[model samples]
Target: MSIAEKLSQMGVTLPDAPAPAANYVPSVRSGDLLFVSGQVSSGADGLIKGRLGADMSVEDGAAAARACAISLLAQVRAACDGDIDRLDRVVKLTGFVNCTPEFGDMPAVVNGASDFLVEVLGEAGRHSRSAVGANLPFGVAVEIEGIFRLR
Candidate 1:
């Protein structure tokens, strides 16, 4: 099935690619690899912001991570000139979580994005990843960047 079809089946509608919050571009094409900048946690309800292990639960952080994943796909679509299917596979993902110094479950939270991508793209979505805790900008719960290889 097409990526759009898969997304629809999962009750997801990719939002328009978000404009950059700073001067940097949202994504860049370097040969066959597309490097997507970190996407912050935000969705229909607005920015999912908070400090994990302080106020937010692991589940909520994961949801925020999922929001970042959705945004990453939107950026990928934009990079592909509106054709996401041109994408070949996910190469890597670097996830950052806003959390207390004591909080550890970064991997579990980032799984939200990884799981979603695999659900949509199957084996192609599997990729190397790194999940780390940091004080993300705007206090957003999670931020994720990705590398994609295009056909």
Candidate 2:
């Protein structure tokens, strides 16, 4: 099945690709690769804001990370000129989690994005990743940037 069909089966409808929050564009293409800017955690309800190891639990942070992944896909779609299937595979993801200084579960929190992508895109979704704890902008729980190889 196509990526659209897969997303539908998973009960997700990609939101409109978000505009850049600063001078930088949301995505840039070089050669066959698309590099997407960081997508902050957000959903229909609005930004998922909190600091893990402080007010947010691991599960909640994971959910926020998943929202970032959705936004990443939306950006990817826009980069492909609305044809997400042109994406060959996810190349890498760098995830940032807002958390207390001692927080040690960053990898598990970022797993939210990793697992969701794998579920939707299967093997193509698998990619190298880095998850780290940081004080993110706007107090959002997560932010993720991605690199995709286009078909």
Candidate 3:
């Protein structure tokens, strides 16, 4: 089935692609690769704001990362002219988690996005990834960026 159909089977409804919060394009294509800008943890309820290991739990941070992933996919869909199936493979993901200096579970937190992508796209979703703790913009719990190979 197509990627869009897969998303539907997973009960995911992509939100409208969000406008860039700064003077940057949401996604850019170069040759056969597409790079997506960092996407914060945002949804209909608004940004998921908190610092892990301080006020939030690892599970909550993971959820925030998952939300960021969803936003990233929305940008990717837009870059493909509203068709996510144009994506051939996920190349890499860089995830940043807002957390206290002592927080050391960044990898687990980012697994939320990684696992979701694998569930949705199967083998094409497996990719190199980095999960790091950092002070994120707007005090959001998580931010994620992606690189994809286009069909």
Candidate 4:
């Protein structure tokens, strides 16, 4: 089934793509690949701000990161004219977490986004990933970017 249909089956309703904060496209299509811009934990309402392991728990950071993942998917569907079937599989995912000096839970925080992909795409979502701690993630708690191979 198409990804949009899959989303419907899963009862997932994508939000509108958030407006870009700077001079950059949200997603870029080159050949059969789409490179999604780094999406911070921001909603249509505003940015989800805080520092994981300091101002927030790992679960909170993970939830915020997953929200960003949803936003990323929204951008993908928007770019593809509301159809998500063009996606073949996820290629890679990179997540950056705003953290404290002693925070060693970057991977846990990024699991927020990682887990979402699997939930939505099943095996197609499996991909190499990198979760790094950052001083700040565009001033948000978490930020994630993804690469996908297109059908």
Q: List the candidates' TM-scores in order.
A: 0.98, 0.98, 0.98, 0.91
RMSD of 4: 1.6
Kindly report which residue pairs in candidate 2 clash with one another.
none
Better of 3 and 4 by lDDT: 3
Per lDDT, the best of the predicted structures is 2
Whole-model lDDT for model 3 versus the true structure? 0.93
lDDT of 4 by residue, 21-117 (tens): 7899888999988999988897656889999777899999999889878888888877787777777888998999998889999999888888988
Poorly placed runs, candidate 4 (over 4 Å): none
Lowest summed lDDT over 10 consecutive residues: which window, candidate 3? 61-70
RMSD of each: 0.6, 0.6, 0.7, 1.6
Error of 4 at 18 (Å): 1.8
TM-score of 3: 0.98
Give lDDT for model 1: 0.95
Tell me the tens digit of each residue's lDDT in model 2 across 63-149: 999999999999999988899889889999999999999899999999999999999999999999999998898889999999999
The models' CA-based lDDT, in order, is 0.95, 0.95, 0.93, 0.85
RMSD of model 3 against the true structure: 0.7
Arranged by lDDT with the best first, the candidates are 2, 1, 3, 4
Candidate 3: segments with Cα more than 4 A from true spot = none
lDDT of 3 by residue, 31-138 (tens): 999999999998789999999999999999889988988998999999988988998999999999999999999999999899988988899999999999999989
